[model samples]
Target: MKKYIPLLFGDTRSIVGVGLRACPKRATTIGSCPYVRMRSLKYSIWVLIMGLMTFFTTPASAALDIEITRGVVRSIPIAIVPFDVNNPNNPNDIARIISNDLNHSGQFQVMPQSRLPQQPHDADAVSADLWKTLGLDDLVIGSATLTDNGQTKADMTLLDLFHSNQSTPTVLMRQSYTVANSQTRALAHHISDIIYEKLTGEKGVFSTRLAYVTVEPLPNNPRHKRYSLMISDVDGHNAKPLLTSTQPIMSPDWSPDGRSVAYVSFETKLPQIFTSDVATGQRRLISSFAGINGAPSFSPDSRSLAVALSMGRTNPNIYIIDLGSGRLTQLTDDAAINTEPSWAPDGQSLLFTSDRGGAPQIYSIDLAGRQVHRVTYLGAYNASAMYLPGSSTKISLLHRDDRGFNIAIYDLQSGTMQTLTQGGYIESPSPAPNGRMIVYSTNVGGRRMLGMVSSNGQVNIRLPEVSGDAQAPAWSPY
Candidate 1:
């Protein structure tokens, strides 16, 4: 038996070790490689297979710094007043959190605290004429009080300032919440969601969660890195590690119910699929196949997983494993590489990547009749495809063009593709539940960080890490 050391770098693979190269523009195959028996792997796997040599144990934090690079030309102007708090020592800023959440969505232009004309905790105290002079359309006023029962009570009122022929602002919505003091941030996010929905007519993702992989070098050992699977709020707060290891973790997919996450881990020096409970740290082994086990995606019902497995073969295939019975059903069996399975909204079919057509492209496979059909033809390379929320006629995928690898939206109805990102280093594009925005990993200044782009290409935001590199962001379903 020959041992292989994993190297992280370019597309070149040698006999000494297996290299987790960056996303290549063209298809590649490993010919007669002893370490990795698979014939070919997609660029999604390339973005996934990082340094797998050694593991070091250390704590890693992924506090994200958000920077908006691009925004819409005409965003809704809104004001969020500083909430009046009874306890001055309380650290949570409910108003600030709501302001940041609305601003980051790219649909609203939030007024700065210093620019606000006045601070009012009640809608009746607000001057509609003064806000109309400031050219604001909406106003949010709230108060958070620490009650005597060791709980926090929050009140929020959304006021519409631009009502037709109305001198006084109309109250659109009013809500109250009572939660533990520690959950004040969550309450704030809920309030933001309510305000957004009342104004935009679409559901807001402020209360959703994000799951990603964060890697950092160990304190004592710079040569080894610590990889951790983390879960955080949509705004990148309350980040807590679900699992941390010296090995690499990749391709995290949240369950539709948001109870568990399925991912590939190399803790045992080989790839294996596991699902960890989001609330608790309990993990259950899903796949331990001999040759390869990667790219685990949850079914719509969350009772099954569509995973890529080699099964001691030279080429990988798609398989469906029942979570209850552990029964494995082969979906595709061929010499061509099939991986990166994404379940359809109805769960009757799946979209996967395969090179059977000479280049990597998105293909659909029906589970009932085992029928396969090619979906994309405009691009020479298209992989990592998933259907956008609420729309089956379109998909979001990583497309390679003359400009390099970027995020693109493909329309199945018109057979056209629209590239979203200009930077060629983008990968692992994950769409939010509402299909208004997407979050993915990109290389910025030679460091991997998370970024977001609105569905219409009007906004771009970078979630730069404070310390480590973040990748493979999975947006949780609300």
Candidate 2:
């Protein structure tokens, strides 16, 4: 008989044959173990659930370096002139922020700063002919000046170079904002959202936030590590810790209104669920069940949470907890592991991972009827499923195939699957609000880093951490 040992390096599915035992009564040090091929499908799922309890802690920094691994073949060509500033040495460049925002979306190709024919802060000073000659469709010009009240005044105008047989560019839009110096970055992201919507007709996620877990070894004691739940801008800037502890934090899911974040914390040396306010550091205990209290997902209304609980049993079942009354409603009672509950956009039903069919797969249960049905059949292992924004028929999930575990999009109607990332070690995929991109944690050079991939599989961007590993990224809603 093979002895069950825990693997403590990366995501649950990516590392094959290795798994962690679930519902430990005390906090114990987790270490790497030799590969033990899974014997049965139930055992495979048991391994996956147990792995969720294994966390490798890192330090407390939010600065991430971005690298674009893939790009779209054809992107819209545009140029953003360096905004004129009274203090030329100012570090916050509004124009540069907008440029990076658009470029990172894989929808726009921004012109290099050195290639611009001219730099104009005002719309009237721009020569449309010069830009048209360079085969550009759109141009953005802006200026930022410091006000006497210690506020920054920024102005921007969007100009269309290809205005139907006209030599003069059409003024698409003009806007201005006067805010505190500290809010200049926020203003830039807001402006980027406007420009992106005006051009693409879809709302931009530039102003959204992301909630994730970060950990690093302690300074005095190399053996102990600090774990923190961090919130940062979508671009991975202005990161601040919401909660920090020596214990493990895992599986952060943002509320639809973007006010609270629900996550699993092992601070008491036992697993518990708590919700923390994004603006305030205030926390409210959600669950402290007997055996296992893990995988907390907020419903669409943000009033209740769908979670997985063992309830002092060996295998976990799905349950819902009302945030107001503390009422518990059990959804699944079975011998198989039913975890990773993701709510549909409507909140009338939930999609969860289960091994009832002898293998892990995506399954859905209606709340009113308590009916269970399998949703994914294309793969033997499909978990961590979430409804892709703007479409109920499609879902983004973790799929395991011959290439190893990767992010994939599964269509419920046609039964088709489209793999997004080529990397075998990818997990915890959270789709952007606009359905344009999916952010997930990936293993790079043996370090867990945050990465994003376009829904169509054209673009892949890696957000590498400055110090230790960043895992379990949950993209906030707009």
Candidate 3:
């Protein structure tokens, strides 16, 4: 029997210690050199230690590299003092939610609560000198009180600490709101929106919602799976399922007003387009043509939907369906496969995928004259094109090259394409309502998950890891 020694460094494990030593007779020259044998054993032990370090430290090193590469380099420094709560066990933390929202935007760097010198809940209590000394340019202070009507009343003050001559912190904005306990999160998001807009010249999308599809394996059967359509806050909190089925649901598009979502559901063994109200879960079949009916996108005015339908033909073509009168108008009448139609900001034309150019490429079509023109010529493969918010000349789409499929933004004026992602099968690029970020789905270790990248290709973030696979994210309007 042999005894082994085990060495542990934190959570890592490695074997150490020398094996049993034996010495042979001095028949051969220097056969009984135990010192030399011990030296070899010591060198072998050192090699083992180095190997253990490589195994345990590589992952952490890689994580740090990722953080540095994806982090915002020039973020504004700010702080959010924890709100004074009337009840210690109150369910909502308004200040914390606001802090997370700002931090996640990649435009602001929020100081940790532990490093805050004082917790101020009012404008008069904020110490401009203390905050300026800490190198903070701005601070947010708020207080939450429980009302007699079982609601919470919150008052927030945004202070700008740049003016040193001012005896008190300069007030940038002040807002007060009263809402039920369940609505506290929404109120916090509204506050974040106000602060963000005041700092940045652009409107904030913190109060917007996200719609996505999640897939998970069945409980008792690993071979079977279940799909769910879910809606959540912009920060991935308070997710509520709208529909779940064994069949697949895909291509969710939010309406202009953010009251309804249109998607494709395969419930009857055939793909059909359906529209559902987000609040009441009431659904209506929008398109169930004889052949392929998919990719339903709402117009800017929300009066009609741009969809792809085969109409018993061999190839799918872009069609516009009037929601009010149930009238169908074909937009593209070509032998090429045209689908994934996205409306322009003006709603006069659309950008859609067409294989008429020998490979999948984006083509722009004018609804009035029915004129078609190639929009993407830089790539051999480009699809799923959508206009970035507030920009009619820039569009985001999936591009394919030697690097595989990636998200790329194309400038129509410059005729140049800039790749956003490094290419890991990234798909479904949906720009946020504020046009600051684009959310897509990518393959992570063979599992599909949601990810977001800034419009300028500065910040990248992966949504929080959860039990199921999340995909097909749609950003709601303001």
Candidate 4:
């Protein structure tokens, strides 16, 4: 008899087994039947011990397991040489930032800086043979120089080692930028954009920003929690509070131009829509309708806002408020709850969450047609639908299944739904400006933190704040 045991890890699968054969009835003195039985028993015991060890050694709830549900089969291989800086105390590690951005995308594997045989500041100095010896597909080298005008001048060159035919590597891209000392980080992100686009043929979102809500316990007032609206780089750096309130702040949406944000705040003991300019620290109340005023989303044109307002009704309806005139036009007049309105990339339609069908589901309403059509049917619960960047055919949203609320993407063209996360509690999915990644909130050991997932359900990342809870991430447009 033969017994087989299967082991599974990611997409990898293997089997371990031992065959037990009856000992020969007539055995020579050199090879006894008793010896055969003892050997078979030892093999069986060894297999059992190994299987138990594997089962116990595997982390059941590892963060990387988030992609076990679905992950990119292949990630691009690239190297980022340490950027040559005129001063050791420059305080800006541009190459590291670029490397982190590409790594976080889960689409590229960056070679470690220590593994490089030499540091090259430009294409002229890059040793094609040395890097090629390491078998890297791509290589990036750059330099940052301090200018007499107190600004920084940065130059980056990307080399395609795969295309190199001679001692010199092929130049895939080369770019130069001048920015103030304070904006050096932004310059690095722009360089990442150039590298990502040249390699993936899709726009990169490394230069984009993220807007999220953070909550912390107030000292001397244990009963009250301070809610803050935070703006930061996509990697969770340079976090600054846009507004802080004792009350809650919810549903943040970035303006089309990425200069301002619209969100629902409870500053006046009631939910109201407010828009704040990122540069000027200016804020304006956009909606204070009689009933609920929530889920404010900016129109693509930036001239109007699509919001959910109850208007003293039993259920909230979709409304479009002209930012200039404050004119309000109701888009949905249903008695059922219609909220969480997000605009299409074209701004001609809106996708919102509604409970008209007895289940919370997503629906679409064309501004001109005024016809509401159901968009989700996979699960009994679906909400928070937003269009992926540079895509109208797909949207990332919250979905509920047996596990709980998780992030999932719905293909409008294929009518197929695929989940991207496995957290027990997950919500508020905001896609990156380039539409290749998503950031959402998840419950991690009773505390709320941010998580990111690639659009293809690969590359899961967690962003946990050191002192507070982060939720409702809204990615800025490039």
Candidate 5:
């Protein structure tokens, strides 16, 4: 009998089994799973218009393996009832957004209140029976009260719907804060953390942000092109355009503190690297290197950046740029095309795509310049690579396997590649803040749009209203 162990990696699936166990009987079934899941995400790519592409999420690699081995699906289903708000104050309610975020991870299937069959609006009316009947494993309930001073306080408690009694078991998690607090958005994320840990034994990424690029075509004027740098809530609702220009913008990366973004902007008539404050919109040029100054990535500390610059004029090499002292540290000296540099969670190494292997594949280079290892070898073209933060045991990338370009991941220890996405030209695959899922861009019926796939690459869902060719999505750190 053939033996096989499927490894979960960046894209949906990249089977690296050496004649492994006949590809497991259930692998194919899991790859085409029909389970419902959700997550917010984006995809990045070189500025190109003529050849419209769609993202093809893979079969396995990142999806849950259920029929056979309990390969462990990472997400948990959650249900958040609309808070019993006596007075509606905030424009965006906390409970509703929190539910959206959890479902957006692609890990948890957020059950709509209407689907729960019967759910009491108040704590007094809530019972475990009603929740269990709806197939909801977890629940979050909250309410807000306003004081005479105009400040409203929100009190929320999470219920272990699986274990709670009719009396409403002890609060699994609770927090009180003023309504409309700038940090209120994070409350849902915190709740995500509690439910995530309780279910999948992992942290939550509800507080993450989705960064994507929009190319608004000028229908009337053929020469006018509106390329925009936009960020949206993971659910694709709060879309706000940040920077706009007639030229193209490549590689938008988030800072560790979530205050700034570094990207390659051609608004100056030439390609250059610039850092901008997300809130204040303050912009600064970091590298105007004569050759190519593009693909800037902020380190975990937010003090330095890893950018692809042709300073040495050798090749598009990687360099560490210090924001404070303007110090430049070269990371790779190879003559191969080394672009798309991504910093590891610990900041010890960086992942980038290089054609040194005849085809563009993913490679990791240590900061000390001692070790250089290839991360992707199965595909002829594996340009973009992203590091999933939930655990260091796995790494993700976008690889092509019959389908255009999709997401794949590599098991560092086992050296196995598995496909994560199914179909379409997916790019800029970024892990959710929790590491359970990835968000990328794929053309929906020929129009590029944002989509999400589970970390194991099983569940796939596209964002609503994000259409007409979108690209280069980055997930913010929670």
Candidate 6:
């Protein structure tokens, strides 16, 4: 196996042992995955490693805000010292992306240590008074060194300033990863994962990937458009286009294994269901059903796709197709426009939008022909339902109010709902891999911009914009 530091992700990098080469514009390929066969052994070892990392620190990465009137209400201020590279292969490595990730989480107040009153190498340094004066709660010192065997390892540590009563406990964490120079950004993401969980208590989705659509205006007329299907990192790093066309692309949902994505593309001048390989960028039409073949969603098993297809069937219906066998089964057959289908947490039932009553509202249905029920009674117009991915039971929808469209969450049990986004013409609410946040698109200053919202609707911010208006945000499973 070859060893290299991969830097394909301009802003993100990772060092990995050979056999993990770039599939080109895709994710790392753990070839033959020798470890796949040793499932139990891998699980045991991963559990042990993560357990140790947890003991050293707790980072609060959840979307829910904690009312810490007494304890630690303010984030533990931490200084992220630029990694001391023995010999940095890339002279232009910027920690900006990683810093942005930490700040976006809102759990850590990061201060650049290069300007610290007193800089220290490890946790045991003589800078307590300086950090306190600067209102810093902790410090992080990290460095990278290439081993003799032609591999790179980044070592990082966390230091907590001992306050009188509100002092943070000493939590130390170290993680070592290998790369082929091409993966430096990925390596940095690994460091982010460690620091995020260490300080936030919740696992960091920093290492996770993202799927989105990039829109460009035509040369002659700005009103007309061109859109490209893109997938990249959660921090908008390493973006690679999946498909480009003159029409709009929507609903890019990743499969369970992160191997493929099910989305609706209009390359043929009409909406159609398509699946593309995450590793190969290969695409295939899964459904071009006569009329309204759009909004494709994957089942929990990834074996089937619950698609909104009309097939000239009066109202848009929910149909399931076995991806492996191409066996199509109709899940809903109604004339009231049953569309925007999303599977339940347990995969036993599906939640979707319907007007079987009067206005568009959310409804639930089972495949066994058991029964169908209405889920959402709030909001006169609700469409495009998306369930929070990764072990979440709450479902989200694109809700239309007197004030443009905002994202809202529905609790099936209490029948309570939380309106997440406000005052932004928001749409396409796709949950991040960690389930703590959702990435969506909203009109900002009359321009469409990508925005992320905390699951509980606390932290809301827009991502960097592209040349044109952006819409249809999707978070990747990986």
Best by TM-score: 2
Give the lowest summed-lDDT range of ten residues in model 3. 1-10
The superposed Cα distance between candidate 4 and the true structure at residue 296, in angstroms, equals 0.5
* Candidate 4 structure lDDT: 0.78
Residue pairs with colliding backbones in model 2 are: 58-215, 58-216, 59-215, 59-216
Q: How well does candidate 4 match the true structure in TM-score terms?
A: 0.83
TM-score of each: 0.85, 0.85, 0.83, 0.83, 0.77, 0.77
lDDT comparing candidate 2 with the true structure: 0.81
Cα distance off (Å), candidate 1, residue 140 = 0.4
Residue 125, candidate 5: how far off, in angstroms? 2.3
Report the number of backbone clashes for model 2.
Answer: 4
User: On TM-score, who's better, 2 or 4?
Assistant: 2
Give the Cα lDDT of each candidate: 0.80, 0.81, 0.79, 0.78, 0.67, 0.66
Q: For each predicted model, how many residue pairs clash, with residues at least 3 apart or on different chains?
A: 0, 4, 0, 0, 49, 40
Model 5 TM-score (2 dp):
0.77
Put down candidate 3 lDDT per residue, 1-478, tens digits, no spaces: 1111111231121123222222222232233435434344443444344334433444432221112125332445678887746543233588878877886786765665656788878788777888776656678888888789999888998887754457598777888888997898899999998888877657889999999999999898868778888898987788888888788999999999999999998888788999999999999999999888989999999999999999999899999999999999998888989999999999999999999989999999999899999998887899999999999899999999889998889999999998888845889999999888888888877888777888877556676655678899999999
Candidate 4 lDDT, tens digit per residue, 232-261? 888787889999999999988999899999
lDDT of 5 by residue, 1-478 (tens): 2111221222223222211211111231234323222110000110000001101222343222111111212334466766646533343666666666665554554554444444444556667776555445467777765567766577776666544545464456666767445555566566666666555556666656788888867778756778889887676666787898889987899998888888888987878998888888889989998788988888988999999988748679988899999999887888789998988889899988888988898898998754889887786888778777867868878888788888888788798888877765788888777677787887656777777777776556566654345788888877
Q: Which stretches in model 1 have alpha-carbon errors above 4 Å?
A: 1-65, 86-91, 164-166
List the candidates ranked by lDDT, beginning with the highest.
Answer: 2, 1, 3, 4, 5, 6
lDDT of 2 by residue, 1-478 (tens): 1111123222233334223322211112113212122323434443333333321221223133355566542345678988745643344688877877887786765765656888888887888888876667689998998789999898999887755356678887899889998998899999999988877668999999999998889889879989989999998889899999899999999999999999999999899999999998899998998988999999998899999999899999999999899999999999999999999999999999999999999999999999999999987899999999999999999999999999999999999999999899989999999999999998977888898998987667776464677899999999
Q: What's the best-to-worst order under TM-score?
A: 2, 1, 3, 4, 6, 5
**Pairs with steric clashes in candidate 4:** none
Off by over 4 Å in 3: 1-69, 86-92
